[model samples]
Target: MITTTGLTKVYQSRDREVTALDGVDLHVREGEVYGVIGQSGAGKSSLIRCVNLLERPTSGTVTVAGQDLTALAGRGRRAGAELRRARTRIGMVFQHFNLLDSRTVLDNVELPLEILGVSGQARTRKAKELLDLVGLAEKAKSYPGQLSGGQKQRVGIARALAGDPQVLLSDEATSALDPETTRSILQLLRDLNQQLGLTVLLITHEMDVVKTVCDSAALMQRGRIVESGTVGELLATPGSELAHELFPVGGTASGPDRTVVDVTFHGESASRPVISQLSRTYNIDISILGAAMDTVGGKQIGRMRIELPGRFEENVVPIGFLREQGLQAEVVDGDPAPKTPAGAPAATAGPAGTTAVPEQTAPPVKEAAK
Candidate 1:
């Protein structure tokens, strides 16, 4: 388990001070894979580095596994021996595989143990076991250049685990690889988390990574966590920006007078035919504008945008009916029209002077859950 209270990190520049983290309070539960997702320059990297005291916070406290890491990290440019010993319990995997070209795969894994004064035979035995754990036992004699990107990362993972850490910190570990490799790496992290009961705190900009392996997630913006919760809680929230970003359902009402509503379905509701039931029960025709569906943590989740035949006032009963069916339905007022391509023909007006726009395709959803 990990907890950070009022964590703040400020960088000193010649001209101005840059605040990477601003009074952030974060908590990661034991044995849970927690994800921090944000765009570049959102302080994700700074926060993770601060967790291990690689970048000491300007202020606040960091507690990991019931130990106050911030207290152990005294005010000094270099870490003392006690702090160094404490860091062995926290493992870190980098985006770029930080393996030495001069060292073989087994040697790379043994580096950490060697630093801890592990004997030669013991280090070799531990490194080989780790190599086998990461499915790179046959590559022990190969150099870094001889391995693929994914293999090199496996070596990095084995090296990190040499310390037998209780917590694993991943800093964009899959960003450099291709999509297939990324998926494989994510799966490996999930496997490691379950197999070793590792408390994983990974920071990434990719929503697919969070959806795939995170038990809970926090969204960072401008060095602040704007939203944090379980994936199901986010999807069920009526106006959650993270939910909209995760499953982007894009569409607009063909006419301004029509009632447009956004609906979210999760858990048991996701498998039910709620839309058809709403249509048949109310004896009203429903036009689906767009929808996105995916599985997270082995549960199906979906978001949909639909249009009704009347104004918002007239569709109140139907919307209430949808809510009764365990759906998060909210009216979208004054839905913006879809933007046309430059020099493209304009949409023609339909009957009753309403512009007719074709349905927009929903964004692709990655089926990342195992």
Candidate 2:
């Protein structure tokens, strides 16, 4: 329900101009969790801010829920009444739970409704409902200072929902929480997306966050969108950086007689016995170097690094065999047919199709999958 065209944002200084977003085009479908990921300087924060006009774009458009936010926000830095009204339909969650310490959990949730001129009784009732929805009803009477980090975030989520927003923007909301808490918060967001039909736009530097919750994702680099697609589409793509980061493979050089091949599994292929079938068909033993299996968007997705008892050229037929079974297979490392005079096979690194194991250790595929 969100779309941007030529969304460019530039910062001006005395000497130079810096562009946080350059000709960025984005589309987030309704009721889906779409993640925008990048490093510290990737302009992810700027993009999220611009979505709600928190950071006005130097040029371009921002449209949400069939309203062109750029047009609603006239030429000034101050927000007009129209823009303010439009913003009420959008909710935002921050990395640091920005709760008023003096206010109780219930009041924190009620703040948004209060701003909307909701009556005291109605706001309290609505706040309680939101708290219950977020599993924080019991903490309604407690102050923010008394709650744990996760609880505070839960309060933040409850407050964001106070306005009954159709769209939710999460700005590193779980970055400050621990891993377990992060998972819980993400699950909560997922549940909200499904139950309330809330369309979520997530900004995160963590790949795991995207892997766990995002239905689709886009990678930002140097103020530009380098890649964007569904999780399975990206995983099946050849040399997809997003997919490689999603399932990192440690590459280790094997003995001269073996060739390393990476096999990518998506959807139904993930359930098939392709590895064993390849061995039986080709009459070659396969060694599992590493594997990473993950469930995203209710689909099984994963990658595996395997070693064949021959050079890469010799195993071409087997790699092709994997492709016929709806799997992506690529040569990770190995030599041509002829071995070097020193009896050492020349190392060849191809595009990544699976997570590579570290050179120092061969972490078993099962453990790696976990």
Candidate 3:
């Protein structure tokens, strides 16, 4: 488990101070894969570095497995002996496989154990076991240059696990790999999490990574966590920016009188023919404008934008019907509606709603590691 409270990291540039983390309070539960997603310069790199005290936080506390690392003595860049020993319990996997060119695969994994004064035979035995765990046992004699990108990352993972850490911090570990390799690496992380009961806190810009393996996730923007929760909770929340980003559905009202609403489906509701039921039950035609479906945390989730043949006021009961069925339905485009009926979910206004979905943009380039 990991928890950070009021965590702030400020960099002293030549001219002005750069605030990388702005009072971020994050919690990653034990034995769960948590993901932090954001574009470049969103403090993702800084956050992970702070977790291991690799980049000391300008202020606030960093707690891992009930230990307050920031409370340990040792000032300056170098950590104290106490902090150093504590770090051995927290493993870190980097985006770039920071392996020595000259060291063989087994040697790279054994580096941490050697630093810990592990005996030669013991180190080799532990390293080989780790190599086998990461499916790289046969590459023990191969050098860093001899392995593929995925294999090199596996070496990095094995090296991180040499100390048998309880927590794993991944700093964009799959960013540099191709899609296939990225999927494989992500699957490996999931496997490790399940097999070792490792508490994984990974930061990535790719939503696909979060969708595939994360039990919970946080969205970072401008150095702050804008949204965070269990994947299912986020999808079921009304007006959740992270939910919209995770399953984006685009559409506009077809005509002036028509009302457009966005519906989120997950859990039992995802498999039901709710749309067809809505159409037949109300005897009203429904036009689907846009839809997206995907599996998240081993469960199906989907979102859809649909149009109804009336103003928001006329469709209040119909919208309420959706909420009663355990679906998150909100008016995304429609004329202003009256006060929602008692016990009925409120309908948000049209494009003029409080939160308008932003246009999709290309993924930003990965930021330089801080």
Candidate closest to the true structure, highest TM-score: 3
Off by over 4 Å in 3: 73-79, 334-370
Please provide, for model 3 over 98-178, each residue's C-alpha lDDT reduced to its tens digit, 9 standing for 90 to 100.
Answer: 999989999999999999999999999999999999999999999999889999999999999999999999999999999
State the lDDT at 295 in candidate 3.
Answer: 94
Alpha-carbon runs more than 4 Å astray in model 2? 75-79, 255-258, 333-370
Q: Ten-residue segment with the worst summed lDDT in candidate 3?
A: 361-370
- Give the candidates in order of lDDT, highest first: 3, 1, 2
The model with the greater lDDT, 2 or 3, is 3
TM-score of each: 0.89, 0.88, 0.91
Candidate 1 TM-score to native: 0.89
TM-score: the better of candidates 1 and 3: 3
Per-residue alpha-carbon lDDT of model 1 for 92-182, expressed as tens digits? 9999999999999999999999999999999999999999999999999999999999999999999999999999999999999999989
Q: Which ten residues in a row have the lowest lDDT in candidate 2?
A: 354-363
Candidate 2 at 161: error in angstroms? 1.0
lDDT of 2 by residue, 1-370 (tens): 9999999999997899999999999999999999999999999999999999999999999999999999977756555778988998899999999999999999999998988999999999999999999998899999999999999999999998888899999999999999999999999999999999999999999999998999999999999999998888888776688888898776655788777767789989999898998787667778899999988777888988888887655655566567777887656644433332243344333353332221122234344334
